[model samples]
Target chain A: MNAYIDVSWPSLLIAASLLIANLVLSAVLRLGMGRRLLVAGTRMVVQLVLLGLVLEWVFDSANGPAVLVLGLLMGVVAGVTAVRRTSIRFPAAYLDSVVVIVTTAFLVTGVSVLGILRPTPLWDPQYVIPLLGMLLGNALTGISLGLDRFLTGVLRDRTRVEGFLALGATRWEAARDEVREALRVGLIPTVNSMLVMGIVSLPGMMTGQILAGAAPGDAVRYQIMIVFMIAATVSTATFGVTMLAYGRIFTSDHRLRSAGALGIELD
Target chain B: MAPPVDQAPILTAENIGCRLDNGWIWRELDVNLAAGDRAVLTGPSGTGKSLLLRTLCGLDCPDEGRVHHRGHPVLDQDRPRFRARVMYVQQQPVLIPGTVQENLELPLRFDINAGRITGDGTAAALLSRLGKSVEFLGQRASVLSGGEGQIVGLVRALLLEPEVLLLDEPTAHLDAEATECVEKVVLEWVDAGDRAVLWTSHDQAQVQRVRRGPSIDLGSAS
Candidate 1:
């Protein structure tokens, strides 16, 4: 395969042109979303441009400390976003989400880097950044969904939870069903996307690689590996977040802190 | 009446209060359930009858005062042990998903109540007393009617043989006959052992029929 030809700035005009159809449709229909769409589109462009600049710098330097700092930053943002995605609130929920998300994302990223895709020391940044970014992004969705379902389910089943507690159930036993359901709900997206990988739609990483002149077979291998890693990261992070959040919401005295005193804040 | 108040009162609460983010539900309420004592906890809606029951069984932390189970403050006792003895059965009990037998036997699965589990014979005997047939054990718990759920809840608590039952309107949804079956089971259970019960009921007749001790009335919200 020929070395990938770089698309210049003028070529981006063609990409930007795609937005005109949405703008025209929204305006012609007098839909109020046109302005919001314009604002969102502009912000997305600005964010991606900034990301491109940052990634270029990191790719050039490949400094160990700098790469780690960036990885931590991504994880933190992902963690915060996960918490923000949930409609429920409790005092320590944010801290729990961040802790679980960052720990799991870094754990999976490290394994994929040093263990599976053993790129040489210099290529570490290239492998670590994307790998961590993808894992963190997926972890954000999974953990957030898990957190949302878990707290919601507990609140919904407050009476049942208390009933179990009243019947000599430990906090873990009372909450076991809710946690299991939360994990299942959080993992569905990753599982479904994997289910339809090559047939329904080409995965983003593989498409990008193929576009950049990598062989189809190599791109498919990377995509397949990523699919496995994503599944792992999502399930582990989701399980961690829900269980940690469960511990936060239920008191040590076999009480659910969801209904009356020390109640969970529902936003 | 109330078996002579002879044995450290199976459960005791002095000036215990229930507070939420909004405000206090009840304040400075006191209750005592001695061996063989049967008392009805009464209050208008929102007066915290349910909250008081929860507070007594160690399911809720009182914003004020403390709960004592068998002479030990709730904090000092092992929680599962404390709760095992003073189980709080809800008005609409939440049955774990599965057969009614699963819900009834759930406490046995907990280490605190393990090894004491009897066979289905005892469970069926108790359920039959509550008007549930033997085959009722196999019915999916999720499909039990509100009244049926309350029966299962009581039977489940009985299977654990809790020393005291903090029943929060356990028969509120039952018809006359079902309610009688529940009262019979509860009264028989209390009469047979060291058990005590603090029950809340909307039915005035139930209060008169069940109480052997002076009733506790948390006066209507001011």
Candidate 2:
């Protein structure tokens, strides 16, 4: 603090080295990864720089409405990005659905922290922003994975599904296996992480809490609460996305015309 | 040649064409099968014979063509319905990963209404038709031989009671005796007044047996 030394020089040097290594290794591998690497590195630098500036404004804003607006915008952008990764078509309603689900889930979780557990100043960037980011991040991942697995199941097992239709299964019945597979895929990582927690190593949340001078017992309790909340939010978001996706698989003729829907094919 | 329009042909292919990458496989191909008609399709290697049969089954789409089952298009949203009415058997049949009974019931898992036909009687009848005992139901799909798997696939399709049946090299891997058995059962199925059969073969003699209908030979185009 006494010496206003620049720490960004080390980070810049590491970033430059990474770019050079990526170019050289991509050429050696002959896989054409160099372009993607360059673009990603450049984008990351520009994005982070811009975000750092923007976040300064966010932190300085004393208005609660401004903070809430920023949070809502962040959740909507995150949800849209996650949906785009599935390469599936969605109705305009889907965006609204994602917005409502993600914002509500994340905010509820955030508010629980405000009133009951960690009594802090309202709209505190230190607590609310980081927690909102974490919850939204997990929810986004769960939604994408759930949508992908469900769509894949529908595409790859079209014959099995049609075979079900022949056997007199309704639309929902035909899609039951796909839904089950998607839900299992979404839930498995959370289940596995829960099983491995504390046995293999300390989780990141617990470590961060401890590092911030909280008691170990308190940190563990907060970590447990976060895990449970994340699991619940993920399940709810996954179910919502999938149910909406199913409606898109059918046509006006009441048949499963899923060939072009979501860019997914029934086998 | 076209069949009568009002008769509701079990399967029809109109102006079918197939091409992949830079190669042209077949063009403007047409065929029709009414109830109880038996047809054999023969061609040399890479003549698009399998592609044509696959197109009939709604598995492969032609570059420019239309397929109809009972006078209904079998493409896009209509495919699931057509697939229910017509079953396609591949050369090396795909067995859904499960026990034999589970594989048989896989189609039922999709359509709950089809679950009604999943009782003991249907399983027994299908097994007997293929000269298999009901005990084969509990066997694992992974443990079956090539012929056994094909038989199971056929029996599974038969349980659906499809109106039209399409086969690709049905006897390619079967022994002489097994081949004869499959032919007999399939011929019997085709003889039923409400059903039809279209099959592919490389053996000239096999194509000649049980002369019930016409044979479309892919000439020079190979």
Candidate 3:
């Protein structure tokens, strides 16, 4: 038997069994939760297949412009998703927020690929795509949660806000409590996940790297880098969105335009 | 800095029109509450009397017109400044989760006019005026009855020393004795020149009590 077969087949079998068991249990329970699992699996299969084809063609493509176009498209999709997930109206500041988050993610991914890790090909799909994707995913989640929580806090506590306003507090002053509360909630999930990482969970990126034949030390090092990148990107993006969106969402009169009118639909 | 104390027409709403859910509550509502005017806004339910009071204080924006306080337009940036000089008391009182003094001082602490206003004498006097001792300041708001709470809410607004006071159904929640006590305190406070008082009341007795000033019947306007 091949050495690779001994290492890989059992892992592959376990993964297949897990997927099958998840589907079977969901169906037997007749709960909608299992449906989401199946949907996620289908989406993962389709997205990976399409990405595989795209990377195969991109690897051989002669034009540098095609790669640039792909990166821009990815950034645009990420920006739209960030705004959409908050379900709040985009203020002019949101454009700045999107630009900041996407640029930071891109810069981080570029630094990892070009300066530090320096994989075989600078634009190698194996390394570059996943790094950028992870950065975008974390940034999007952080900013959206921050924005939603901030706005919800302000809208729910009208009397408290009015009391502050009537007391000679500026718009920002009245919103100060709500703003802090929102930010704390936004940061909690990320901080908790970071704290429990490696002890309670073997994060996906580390596990995937190990499965792909990377040394355990190398996988852990890459995982640490990813964690740092995610924390930094999330902090920056969430702050940027909160600061920018706060201006548009409230009138200078200190009255909030209804949160519903913002036309944002969060998932 | 605080505004000039003796300015005329401390609050004014010019041709104000407000609509709620496709119904006009009030339209072309004009009012000029000069310093120490001590006016009362009386109307039947659903006449937009409360909306008019809110508009004058810049708490609610009118679709058709503007509100000016002491010559300053109550626009967005100027709102906090304007609100500092005015106080809007709602029909239902909402006391912050704290002791009486904490609830009373809530606005002052958050407002930019903190140093300019005095809460010490006001809290003590207000509690006494509403038939409560100064010791009540240590009591939590959750312990107050409806009559006691409304009186506390009034005292909280009074503590801010707002030049223009907007009261919405202030006495509706009070017993006769508490109502008289609150009315006596408010009227006495507004009696001093340079303070403007405009209030809304469903109780005809309140209208009669402050009957000396011009009464705008919003029900007839509609």
Candidate 4:
């Protein structure tokens, strides 16, 4: 039990039998979620299985370029997910999110891998891919939360912002409060998770490592390092995306662009 | 305080235009506010009077023409300074989250107002003159009535000693007594320095009282 327990296809099928409970509940309650649950379950298995095959090849071959490309693709996906989650949107938001995510993900992960871990070859897929994956996964939520707060906040605070502008406050001066609040909101989850890191429950990364037979202390250290890296990535991406969105929302003349000009859409 | 140096108009608009989302509100409009000028911007409710005042203050862009502040392009390189020179007071006063004094003091903290105080006049003095107590400064902005908010907004702009105030029905929310007090304070403010006001009023009586210079009528616009 202390070592890794390999799960074959039959074992995976046994684990998946848990879905039967959901199906049974749906039939008994006449809940309409059965088809949705089935589709979602199918998606998860297919996506993860495909990921496993791709990850296996990259790890075995130790292909550096493939890891970089895959990491960028992950960032692109993360960026799209971040924008999609926002209830209100402006034009070219996808571009802002993608660029910010890719750059922030690379910058933070590269610092951790090169500066902290000193991984071999610097671009080693084993170290690079999973770290980028985890950072993107977390940064996605933070960036989305930040972008949504900023867009909706400026609109809601339109009068106050323009009031400042009317009296000679620069655009930055006018909107700094909203920007500060958005950053605070986006960082809340990361800060809270950090608060209860060890005492409340074991983190997912630590649990996974412990299950794979890494020493408890080693796993704990790794989790701490990764969490710190995630905080850095998330904050940086959130700030970057919010500032970019602000640039788009306020015109060069410093007027809050007409909502029509922004082509704002609601999800 | 001194007699005038250049004697240029405090604020100027040349062939300006404005547009709403659906269509043009007005176009090829020209208006100016000079020292001792008390101009009126009159239009129907939806005919773009507020937007015109915003354009003069550089808070909104003019669609077709230029705005000048004391002989310089108003919306050019140093817009904050231009805005400081030409203030816009909203019809319904907008205050930030804080006490009334805090809202008034926030704009004075801008780099444009760094060391730009005009006189020994204080916000307390202004408020008391408007029949509000010195304690009014400490009142929460959220708790202030509509007329109180308008007074705070006016006092904040006057504290900056703006050369021009693009007022959009500033007295609309005030009762007759407060409106008289606001009009007197504004008139005194204009008389005290080389300043001007571009006023908008739905009330015909206030318009008659305040119109001492040019009038911008949007009544004819279709």
Candidate 5:
């Protein structure tokens, strides 16, 4: 009835031929990616199917609490993933990640849905859940890069930092450079994406919307909103996590805490 | 120049003990550095001479004792003030990115030194004493030789005018000329009165040249 076409099972089977082509190429090149490719492809299909079913029920129920709970669960997963992506391991790192990711994702999504999108009867699963997922995913990446750079910078240039401390600098003064650099490193990815969003690539939201038969102009506007939201959330998360992390790294005595306190070994 | 034994000690370590993963590096150590004192610390490698200096400057806490400055026990809250008064210069000095003048001006920018900014004339005078012209201040720090960088670091510490200077082989990387320049500047600094120094050196000749008071041999200590 509508311009959007349904992706039936028959069409999906036809698409499966692409995987055979990939497997044949991997085998010929002896890339050792044959098994990995198959496993990953299978996992993607299974996970997406599962998510589709869960999302169906969620949308049908139209429950605000259910949507919020699901968003929070995604945030927690994102938090754990962010910490694991960084080499700096600390006892309270996961807690730091969780706080930063959850707060930024919630605030950005809340503002977008309630203030900008104004999806009727706020907390509408259709809008809230997807926006939350996108924000959480991007925020997790930014916070991870920030944390990694901050910790590694401190570790590498410890002598320079201590030199400042020895000259009577406060903890904040000693760490100012590292903190600024970390924030910059975190924001680079989102900034680069914004620079070439439409020309270099059609973003996921816009592409999906167009495939669903939405007007190009409307889809572009939504994509622009999503990018702006992501940039704000990522920067906010990076700044928040860097501030919390520096406190834990330096003690009240203005000395660098031992690696043991961070639950990691310094090589 | 012997210290005034009658005056209060500028710094004191009470039964100070330090340990490493291997075992006790030093134990039950006691020393008093009085005004105008120039004490030399000597030991073989691994005796933790630098570590001892770090502890005295409040950079490292001893496992079993405390350090005091002018009869006041050094605490966590008082560390910034304590470090300001008792400065420690490592063997290899670290310089932040900037010109020599900027490096010298850094300590003055600290909150503790807010009201005590060193005048440009003082920096010039200090640089002159170290065989550097006032124009040397404009030279980029990254381009300076190791010896020149060490001089900049020394001038920086001198501008702060700390009460006690814990020198960790400050001239280790310097040529004889540079070494003499450092010694000349430091000697003039201590001549001003009420200042003290504890320097570590393996060169007996340099020690004899610089030592105005007693030398403590940490290598022989238990």
Candidate 6:
């Protein structure tokens, strides 16, 4: 009785008109993005279609390890994207990024799937994969913002931080302000989104659920949980990445490493 | 008067060299500071006077040589305590965004300086020596003039009762009266017989007034 209407392949082909419209607009405006737009649309279609097939196989097999491996693969991809988002460079950045994203995603998704949602067959591909994707994606954005801000802040306030060091401050004391500011910058986006949730816009997860014929109240509850999970994931990931990255900026002797370490001037 | 030459040097820099992005600032530089000694670091512009002072305070590491505090190499474990005793004041001192008193009290909040907090009258006394009133401590730090900010920085360093003070052009922006006030307070601090001062000043008069001992010319070393 709760079955939902599904779009057939013929109906889906009709959706291609939107991309045609965009391509025509790019042509009329003489925008250089025409080729890029075409490439992007093609890639999206190919990737999503492939993902649909993969998910169908995954859901049918319901293999716990396979689902877990897929989630980790998604995290690694997100982690690489996150590192490219920041201009600052340090030792082991890719490893640090992956550690933060994967750890936070696992923690949040694990808690939601096993403890809160408690779906049958705990590693159920349907529940675990989507939740991990959502958590990892948001965590990547938060951590990249934090890493960029903190590194830039250190470069900007090198003198002030050195002043603290000269005054006998521990390394943590020297960088505490910059770290706090970076974490705040990372959290602000999620905090602002939470503030405007539902009233201004329907979030992706909620809208998806509603389109699948879920009741409005059920969709809203899922949206609320997802937002909280996102906020938690962002906080943890940002903190973890920022703290881990500080080791590369400051030497073991507690002195600020040379500008070469950050590939920028601190003077 | 300089402390007796027999007193052991409180700090020493041997064959020290520092290189910035461009080139070598100085090399094979040697210096010694004994208790109650007044040493002036004189050099031409761009001769690394500030960089040398930073090295002395362990804020920077020398590329080629070692710095010893009381005969022990200043290692990572020793830096916190070493910097506590050897304070370096920048030419343009930085203050946190707060009241003057808050800025002065900032160091005491650190773990190393915990329980070493100055009493109510301590900052007031240091300010009075600089001809600043007790009420001056309440003024916003950001609004203070350059001379006033430098004076607050001096008081903050002085409050810590450091064994050696490495002052890098501390009076570059002060008026004659304020400079004189700073000079007098520094002289009184060195008069304690167990402390040392290494100051850099472009002003010949101020340099002559402060150095009771030999002046180290960094320009020659470069």
TM-score of the second chain, each candidate in turn, equals: 0.92, 0.89, 0.90, 0.91, 0.93, 0.94
Candidate 6 global lDDT: 0.86
For DockQ, candidate 4 versus 5, the one ahead is 4
Which candidate would rank higher by DockQ, 2 or 3?
Answer: 3
Q: Is candidate 3 or candidate 6 better by DockQ?
A: 6
- Residue-level lDDT of model 5, residues A192-221, one tens digit each, is 999998899889989999999999999999
Q: Give model 5's TM-score versus the native structure.
A: 0.88
Tell me the tens digit of each residue's lDDT in model 3 across B76-158: 76787777778887666667788988777676666566565465486787688788998898999888877777787788777
Each model's DockQ? 0.59, 0.17, 0.54, 0.62, 0.57, 0.58
List of clashing residue pairs for candidate 4: none
Q: CA shift at B172, candidate 3, in angstroms? A: 3.0
Ranking by TM-score: 4, 5, 1, 6, 3, 2
Least lDDT summed over 10 consecutive residues: which range in candidate 1 chain B?
Answer: B1-10
Q: Which CAPRI category fits model 4?
A: medium
Estimate TM-scores for all models.
0.88, 0.69, 0.86, 0.92, 0.88, 0.87
For residue B140, give model 3's deviation from the true position in Å: 3.2
Tell me, per candidate, how large a share of the native contacts it keeps: 0.72, 0.25, 0.61, 0.70, 0.48, 0.54
For candidate 3, the TM-score is 0.86
Candidate 1 vs 3: which has more TM-score: 1
The residue-by-residue lDDT of candidate 3 on A147-169, one tens digit each, is 77876666656666765665567
lDDT of 4 at A209: 89
Chain A TM-score from candidate 4: 0.93
List per-candidate RMSD values in Å.
3.5, 7.1, 4.2, 3.2, 3.6, 3.9
A188: Cα error in model 4, Å: 1.4
- Highest-scoring model, DockQ: 4
Candidate 2's residue-wise lDDT over B190-212, tens digit each? 78658888888888788888446
CAPRI classification of candidate 2: incorrect
> Candidate 1 clash total?
0
State the TM-score for model 6.
Answer: 0.87
**CA lDDT of each prediction against the hidden true structure:** 0.83, 0.71, 0.74, 0.85, 0.85, 0.86
